[model samples]
Target: MHLPPKQGAAFDPLSEAFARDPYPAYAALRATAQPVYYAPFDIWLLSRYADVQAAALNPLSLRSLDHLMSADEMAEERRAQNWHDMPFHARFVQFSMLNADGEVHQRLRKLVFREFTPGQIERLKTGVATYVGGLFDRLGGPFDFIEDLAAHVPGLAIGRFLGVPDEDCPQLRGWSDDIVQYFDIDRTDARKALAERTTKTFYDYLTDLSKHRRRHPKDDLISRLIARWDTGELSEDEYISTCMLILMAGHGSTIDALGNGLTALLRFPDQRLMLSADRTLMPTAIQEMFRYDAPLPFFHRYASEDMEINGWELPKSTKIGLLYGSANRDPEAFADADTFDITRTPNRHLAFAAGPHFCLGNHLARLNMEAVFSQLLDRYPRIEPVTEPVFKPGLSLRGPKSLPIAVR
Candidate 1:
């Protein structure tokens, strides 16, 4: 009997060192020239840009294995993953527009797809700008960029879009953080309890909010979803799940992107100076930032059928982890993958994973980054980091934990 070499042995995602710099490990994984089998998770990790892209574009590469697994099998798998006990997390977070495939994915996606279209998201630009501007107006001295600024914008922007009260946005942020933390590799019992508790609380809040929308429909995502539910187009679980998905997906990810972008600018002052000189590079710079440090880096897919990828044959039900952060920094994909160039052309980065499940809130996330970075450049002539930024330690998410910046 032969054993599968643990190629992922060096990849310790839970370590603080990895959080500070995972690119080195990612590079090593990609150098192996084949998918690395991580025995701990029983999954093959795809690190190269081409491999990740292939897996993402392959229809057989599914987000959820429920389609192929039987009820008992799924239950057993969930139990193995410690994902069985949480009823609310299983209902809402486990099965969502994000995890569904085929017709089911399309149907759930279309329900709120229009709300995220460029034009629709564009409408909220003015509001986001106003909100971010107000935040800057109140800050007169040095502050933690993550907690003080980046943390505030995404929640309010997404909250307003969902018709969540501005006052409740802070609480929503807390709920989102707690729930999202459990999605990472470290699923401790404490984290699991927090995730379930927050999920239930969030579900309850959305339940009450949906009731209000039912009584008096408003011009918000929740109201629109409620209308769909009333028309038999959506189930009660789907409605709540969709709302929770939107808030959770958009809130923390955007905040991380904002912080990562700022940290990039501060670290590569030359790039920041170039952006200041040529404001037109903001869009490309935003893309570069996402590529440089993708907030949501590790996403998994299960093979629905046998598939050949990067010279390796994967059997049915095989789990493949797509390292988006690593792909973005792959040298073959970008001329100078490691360099943070604001003006890099033809940057087809997978910061937002490609194919059917490409991030729905991508446009909104970009708009938020543009508004915040643009304001930072316009409002303050000199911005400097007060201390070394410490990134949130996780494989699932990437961003500085806090970034204290002095602005004038």
Candidate 2:
């Protein structure tokens, strides 16, 4: 398959070189008929800021996830390779708000939104504090930040949300890693099979936890979901899928953000120092980090009808991947778009996508990030990188796989 030029070459998403450093290629794309088309992937790449924003704004024209495909798109993209795969588990993404559209999307989102009420999120700070406290005590110099710290933040946070005990949070992290590979780059039959099995195990565990909660409800997300299910707003299938969605999407990107954001902070000591001097800048600093190194670079969408983007005509049902990563760094969107600046105002980065499919967990994710960075900056006067970071490959969600650093 054609891939982004390895090293400092053309933009190819499938190459390890691009995965390590994609910005140069993305920049090259920005300087051309970008996001126009990729012969290998057989999908349009929407890299321009306006086009990516347009896709997210017009979800009706460009869909997210399965929304199940309306039977027509499914028949068309059976390989599911074109952004509408359903082979793993029927309706696997069925109840997921990420995969729904219109009324169904609204309904699913409302159910979730209510559960994440402002009051509920505020109360979440206690658990977050506790997890961060424990994690900080054990972190020290000469450590793999991605594995030792960044990876655990989301796991512990989600564990508290899912009511998994502290001890089991580590195991849950493992299950999360194995199962989330369903969205990984280049899935072999072996990888797919392993992911399915891992997912089933994770799903079954949650199902049992859900059943137990039904018998004796608690103040956890699963219980809240069960409560909604009992009220007839959610089906058992929806209940299961929604729980999985929260467990996966909820924590996954935050972990990635922490890795990507912190790496950028370390690489740009000036910006990191600026944020340290003025804690109020934390919020904006995080925003800049997102724009600088978007956790996930692109979002997937299937063309709902014939449409034109940046002068390119896209036929109905065509697969499209919106390049938010590139857009965040587009010169037209941000002055010195490639530079890492925490003080950047009006930083409208598409790290979290936008419109109806705008990240539902944005508030929680921001809170978690702020909390983690606060602890890190406070504890370590210097977060020194011992080695170069490595990235996990995918057109979507991108982050460092390993970031070894020295904390002092």
Candidate 3:
């Protein structure tokens, strides 16, 4: 019973309309087929649950973005970006593990995986409560939740988890912000250049800091990573790259999810009230937010060999965009999948992504959301939006740049 995958609408992931609200477009895509050949992005997009999972869990598939390229595409992008003139940007491309797989990813992920366990995240709950409590206490009026609360709180938690000096947490966030520009699918050469400069400075500073930590070991992730580096379990580049990646990945999505989650709660009053009445629902409620709207839109995989998805033959090295945002909302997977129901049982959405590269910081993110939103319910009797939330100008990530919420 193999029916042909339906033809999907034209998708422009970077278009302005897509950024503010992409679900409608995503819904259309999901209705069509399991995987659609989106010519605009030049990648096959998998919107169905089964297709997305297959792409995610298949070990033969490649996680590295570099795998999506042919040597010609690389040469063209190099000419387009003038990256060779920028040493640090070039070095970043070479060393980053985001696009690497196999032993490199394993070694890089292993160095810090022990300290990044779910149990460790559970332990950070107390610290999350403390940091968020003080932050909420300081808010006295109409506040930009994204800037004032969502952004800073995650950094504070990450700072504590990584053993960064409390004072340097804000500094770490600055670097996280800059490095995230690379994730922006629509970033210009100018912005990419700025991000590269920031990352170079960021890399140099952290490398020096890691050296200091190696000599004077501390109770932190970097200290532990340095220990492995000393024992020859990790390379210098891999160690430095992991430190940078963890901070960006750990801090960025959590901030977006927090902003997105709080906004969702405000929009859906019934669900909000339900959570407020029964605190037991916080876990499921957070899961709902993730499923309803993933903060990040897509994850990519490279075809290891010729493959068929939804009847489309993808040649080796073909770039595939696993549309996690769309997949989570597929009605085939969940009843009334578009609704924001906090009490969703067995809500196994691919918000953290799927398979080996599933988010390493998911537990920490959940802990932070629980800490902040629970306190938020008590802190504000009602939250009214001053304006429609303004999202950052990109399709790759979703979150308000500023969400002015009047607390009464």
lDDT tens digits by residue: candidate 2, 1-408: 222332332456778987898888787776774355453555667778987888778755546535536667556664655233433343453346777778877888888886566576677787787778788788655888778877888777777766766776776666666656666446666666666667677777877777777898877777777887889999887877777777778666788899999889988999899988899999899898788888878767777776666566666766777888899998998999988988899889998889888887777788788888998898888888988888887667688888888877
Query: What lDDT does the true structure give each of the candidates?
Result: 0.89, 0.75, 0.79
Candidate 1: lDDT of 264? 91
Residue 51 shift from truth in candidate 1, angstroms: 0.2
- In candidate 3, stretches whose alpha carbon ends up further than 4 angstroms from where it belongs are 1-9, 65-86
Name the better of 1 and 2 by lDDT. Answer: 1
Worst 10 residues of 2 by lDDT: 1-10
**Which residue pairs show backbone clashes in model 3?**
64-99
Candidate 3's TM-score: 0.92
1-408 in candidate 1: lDDT tens per residue? 112466545678878889899999899887864545573666778889998999899888999988889999999998888898999998999989998999989999998889999998888999999999999888879999999899999888899888998888888789999999998877889999999999999998888887877898888888888889989999988888899999999889998999999999998999998998899999999999999999999899998988878667787898889999999999999998999999999889999999999999999899999999999999887899999998888789998889999988
Q: How does model 1 score by TM-score? A: 0.97
The deviation in Å at residue 147 for candidate 1 is: 0.8
Write down the lDDT that model 3 would get. 0.79
